[model samples]
Target chain A: MGIPVTIENPKPEAEAGLNDLVALVADGMARVNTTILSRTGSEVAMIPEVANHLIASGGKRLRPILTLACAQLCGYADAEGRDGDVKLAASVEFMHTATLLHDDVVDESDMRRGRVAARIKWGNEASVLVGDFLLGQAFRMMVEVGSLRALDILSAAATVIAEGEVMQLTNAKNLETDEAAYLAVIRGKTAELFAAACEVGPVLAGRGEAEQAAARAYGMGLGIAFQLIDDVLDYGGTSAELGKNVGDDFREGKITLPIVLAHRRGTAEERAFWQRTLQRGEIEDGDLETALAILRRHGALEETMARAEGYGAEARAALDAFPDGPVKAALLGAVEFCVARAH
Target chain B: MGIPVTIENPKPEAEAGLNDLVALVADGMARVNTTILSRTGSEVAMIPEVANHLIASGGKRLRPILTLACAQLCGYADAEGRDGDVKLAASVEFMHTATLLHDDVVDESDMRRGRVAARIKWGNEASVLVGDFLLGQAFRMMVEVGSLRALDILSAAATVIAEGEVMQLTNAKNLETDEAAYLAVIRGKTAELFAAACEVGPVLAGRGEAEQAAARAYGMGLGIAFQLIDDVLDYGGTSAELGKNVGDDFREGKITLPIVLAHRRGTAEERAFWQRTLQRGEIEDGDLETALAILRRHGALEETMARAEGYGAEARAALDAFPDGPVKAALLGAVEFCVARAH
Candidate 1:
């Protein structure tokens, strides 16, 4: 009933190591999944019914997978390590789900992942309530993790993400956007989770503080790279893969990185087009095409790619502290995959 | 500028004890308050400005006081005893504040304690973001409490509180709001915090399981009683003293204790009124008075008061485990105050 993140694209050939790592995650995820999804166990009709609808919408569990992968890669023992690795992984996913639920409500987005959003299906009240339910579920999962350090990281990440959202709102349609600001927003909103997901693994693994920091950094960098690519894909990705109406950002008057770069390099004529349109928070026909042309002319799309590459490199560097193993290698590939994925 | 709870009621009497606690909480809250009341320290400019208005609102530290009082009554030591008490108490306030910030957003409330609500001031996006910030700050503060048990209790409470919010939203206005069902919601939303406050005290005091559970029970029962009183006051209390808009709950289409009781006992004619006004999800002119009269006629208001009294008695029973001392007496007074307060 809610906006579930659907992946319509055919599964890419996950690198061999990544595939194996995901198989391990799938097991843990199934175990944690039951508890995370049960928002209302009450006999009350409205609650359990509406709750069931929201939970029934499947999610990709990207954040959880990153957590499980990072923990396994960092050599947190599946056999001997703490239970937190799985719970924390679930916690991250819960946090992610809560945010998405709230995001749909805030954006007033009617559909997500090719289905009517929860807000639309159940009403804004249900959407907001379910969002709160997911949040509570996240904290419940965190309590099971029993690591204050992990709680601190995840909670802090949530705060930062919220701030990022606010920042995004205030920046809507103001065309003087730049790379630095865009990156900052991305890091706060998107990267913080990516960072938290990866970082929590090290902490849960009982890895030393240094390794934990390293993992955190890796997640942070990868998250930024991932978000940047997402911004680009919003402009370029097909409807089937993106599960979004193309040019949603432009239509919503969001000033993303490509637009920021193009705006930076605009000629007087191009500048006039945006100043009269985008900066004023208005859109005209073919505005999306014109914006794409500006990005191409300024080589802004390529610059955006270059920035993603930079973050990917940084993410890789952050993982250097991990022990050399298949899991580590898999984590490395995942970062690459994070940036390189088509959708 | 947003409505401020701070301006609504400044606790001059509790200020000394609370200040000692505030001195401890001020730094973390200041940071969280800044981040919460402000934007993400990124590109967007309006978030922080909006946040500032909401954070400055007046609110009493009743929850924290209960936490500190519980600890003091249990003869808790900071490791350093009193100093520890202050920190722990402040942690309670921080958590409560964090929840408040988040609650306003979830509820889409436009006012708090006679001030413009945070969401209205900052928009839903910033309010939500700041609320997240406050939650994170709360965990950070708890971490400073330095006990795994403290983290566990607080985390569980956080989850329950969120769940309570969900329950409240789900349970809104259908008129099936039975006493048992209503208690569950109140426990999740209100009692959990009160219970956490008391339990955290004993944990800090290095008390045994029996004492901790007893203290937690005391807080939980008190919270329920307190909420019952709140519902009662909503119908009867003057807006001048309560600092809340009268009939706002009805306007929000909520089905609380009085209405539930009235629905059960009212005449067929009254049932028609209830169905049309409450279940119909709209309160028309003079409906508040009519509803109040129905409640009185059916003894619904008195029944609610009696239920609150029963919980208050139960709250006192939970404290029987504690010693006979001034701290214990204060804790008792606080419980009484929770239900007995005019505003």
Candidate 2:
């Protein structure tokens, strides 16, 4: 052998775990997909066209699945056939979809979910307006559910998510960003929404505060782990795995944990390279490859994944309060699957 | 005089009526303004900066004033000092401000309320995010008031507003956009918010459905009138009076009633002129003057104002069910003031 390089293989168990969670929520998810499709319709044809471009392009409805699974775990049966959980789950997805649309526009992203972004197909104007349309529809659904507590959690999450995006904007291309700052940004943007999505389920079921808190904690940990894994994948993963360009974070100068660790553990010359490529946005032909090499040499990706594993462990622990049922196992497995995606 | 042109002078009574309404809602307006300022704060500096750039640059607070006036008219005394109307008024203003920020970005506007737009100063990303932040905060405040009805009304209005905006985008630069389509667009974008704002006041007061309907009717009529006057002023009003650059709508080839009326009534030659200037977006120097001359020749501006007057009459009639009081008179006067702004 020339070099005997170590290879990390994809975990079948991780994929199976995700599938189990999906299967567990299949019935509710079907209704959610239907609700989403029907609600995106408007007299203005462009609204639905733009919305469906992203919604129809599959992104793995992880957040809504979490909402539904959490609701079921909390003993929600819809005895009166209110279907509040279904509506709330749909609302969660809408909020997530709205943020994705706006994020694509903000990042000037070209592809999302392995297809041309809505912003690219329809102009940025349509992307922005349709994103607002989805967000408005999300709140309307929440109001229909008639739960002020759910509204409070989701709306506050929306505010924090916006703040996180703004913070990310400010941190973009800034090589001095530290790990704490990186965690703060991701917590606000990513984890907050996950927490809200999970918490709203228990609120809908009228579960006790302990159950809601457990679900919220689990989601928060899972989300942090999810984002960390995503950041690592942006460097180490393949385009097929990501369903988008692999080096988008690097190309966009998006500051993330991997970049932060790499910058911190780098030499003076490497730091200067990052400043030139990211801060000043000057990239040569080999800049991406060079960046990857630096990250590899510093073991930044592995270290980031380590942090993700830590969060995943916390997520698994958070579900300990629930009875040992298939739903709980699936939720815990979600945390494992999220972390193992890096392999 | 060479032509003995008819002159329309500004009405002092109309101005006085607006001032009277403003004075009546002064106490609540102050609280609303304070709430707006405080709620815009975030740890991310860019959010408050972008938000304040619009909020402090003061567009007339007519929407919130209507909310307050309508609440007072419905016999809402805030007996327990809940200040639901105050919070609701602030929320209305926030929604309005969020729409304005997004609208400026969608239109790619350079100036708003006599100040440089937030998008221009901070870039479109920040503007869009800040707008979302404000909208999230709007719903949070509505939720805090514990009124699902208010949330329903406002959320529905937001969805309609987004649809209207999309419709308007589709109609832009299209000479085939007729009066009915134009009316639908404006009613969705502008009138829906006004109607919801007025209706929420009654909802907060726990008034009867008829009172809520009447308030909504008044708001819808006034909003249509207000938009018509704004359209008329785009070509005829002064820059100082409009607080923005005149001819922006023409420069953007935005389809409005005046353009529709002028195009519908124009000869073949005039239609070609409009097609070149508006439909093709090939505006040249002196094109605005030519457009104004064409509007005057067809009496489009006057006819538009006459239509606004008719809506103003309907708005006044909507207030007929309420008892005669300073608040009711002030609300009616506010309608007259909106229509009179064209002069």
Candidate 3:
């Protein structure tokens, strides 16, 4: 086996959890998808072309779904004038897609969601401008919702995500990058948006601070779990399973959790190998396979999943304040779904 | 003369108008500058590095000054709890700077404000991410002000700006792009922000809709005039005067007003020259000089300035309802200053 298969019987956790989550938020998701399509429509043909290219590419619409589910869990209803959650959820997706477009450009990525990257398809200039258009559209939707609190959450998250990107850039190819630094980067890049997406749901519902905090914590935990699983899958999962090429993070010299773990646990010779391959970006033909072997030898993938499980547990715990309703159950299942990518 | 020197003795219009306007809103401008500096500060080293590289690169701060001056013209005072204009003005600068950074990247520019472009200094990735950071900060500041109307104005402007950018992309190097299409491009790319900047001031001061509309009109007119002058300067002005390389627009094959005018009036051979150099992008040595000779032959520069003057007069007319005062005079003078660039 290219990767050590620790789970003798891997459960279909992602399939089941995602299906249940989608069912729980089906109506809201439908409205959100419609809102996304309508808002992304522009007189400028290039705007729609670039935006739709990314939006239409199949990826789980998890962040927006979380927004809707959290709103439902908070008991928000249209009667209470909280129907703006639908738009806000769509805004969350736009923000996510915008970041992805910019991220692909930053990463100089070749593929996304099993297809050529937008940057590769249209060029870097188009990717950057289209990303800006999406962000502008996102802010417009947030303004339409007329919630200063929600706007605050989402805008601040946008800043955090940008900062996270910069942080990731600084840490890339630096084998000396530590776990705390890794956590901070992921928090800014991945968890912050998730936190904002879920937190705004409560803000839209006019829920109390505790409820908002709980929702935010749930999202942050799930997001961290999701990213951790992503890091592991980069080394071990198939493109069919992950919807992206395996070893991409390696090629990009991204210092994810497994890399950090493997580096910390490695011998002096192994450290030199990482330094040359990752830090110097001088990868040879078999470096990726060797990296995978090193990761398995150090139990890095296993430990990374264990860490993801911990975050998943934390994510579930954050939903304790809400009653054990369908929304909460779906949300808890999302945490399971995200972490189960490692399986 | 390449363009008609309508002003026999050219006044320092931009310099004088900017000085008077700054004096009128000196306190607000200072505060706005402070807010800009503070908001752009981040723990991420690359963000500040890339952002400051551009923010300090000697932009005239014209957009923020307009924001402050317009707020003052609307009688917004800190005593009346309209101090948020200072923040909003800074936010406007942030938005403008953010766009400039992205624009340089999109345009593949090597120089900005007589210095190397941020993209050259850092990278396209840094410039794009830092630009996003500034925009996120802009939205956060808007949210802090808690004015949905102001947010609405600015957010809509942002979308329009993005659309304008895409429109420009589609129109780039196309010889057939007409004056109407050119006007539409400038309206989206340049004037929308100016209109939004001025309109938000009135919104903050709780002015009537007519007053807001007037302010927007003034800004729109001045902005179009400003951009018209910029297009003229690209061909005739020195690098020292414009803070960018002359012929940049021509080199990039940007179909500006002058180009449209020249194309419409050109002989068949001249039209063929434009098609080969612009539409087909086979730019030969000394093609810029030939293009200049053609613009002069058609009086495109003079006619472009005439159009700008008309808009300047319209801008002054938009302020007709307001009482004569230092602010109003400075505002009117700004129109002269903007259009005077053609002289």
Name the top lDDT candidate: 2
Q: Name the regions of candidate 3 deviating beyond 4 angstroms.
A: A1-11, A80-82, B1-10, B80-82
lDDT tens digits, residue span A69-176, model 1: 888776677665446777787678767776776788778787676567777877765665556556656776776667778877887787778778877776777776
TM-score of each: 0.87, 0.97, 0.96
* Interface Cα RMSD, each model: 2.9, 0.5, 0.8
lDDT of 2 by residue, B271-304 (tens): 9999999989998988888888898999999999
Candidate 3 on B248-305: residue-level lDDT in tens? 8988889999999999999999999999988888888878888888988899999999
Grade the docking of candidate 2. high
lDDT of 1 by residue, B1-343 (tens): 1122211232444234334444433443444334333332333456445544554565665676666666666666555533555555556665676567667766667777778776776676666665565566566566656677887787777767766776787778678778777888888888899899889878887889999999988988888988887887777765666667766777676788888888988788998888788778666777877877788788777788788888989988988887777667666666656655522
Worst 10 residues of 2 chain B by lDDT: B1-10
User: In angstroms, how far off is B293's CA in candidate 1?
Assistant: 2.2
Off by over 4 Å in 2: A1-10, B1-10
Q: What is candidate 2's CA lDDT for residue A218?
A: 95
| Candidate ranking (lDDT, best to worst) | 2, 3, 1
lDDT of all predictions: 0.71, 0.89, 0.87
Q: What is the docking quality class of candidate 1? A: acceptable
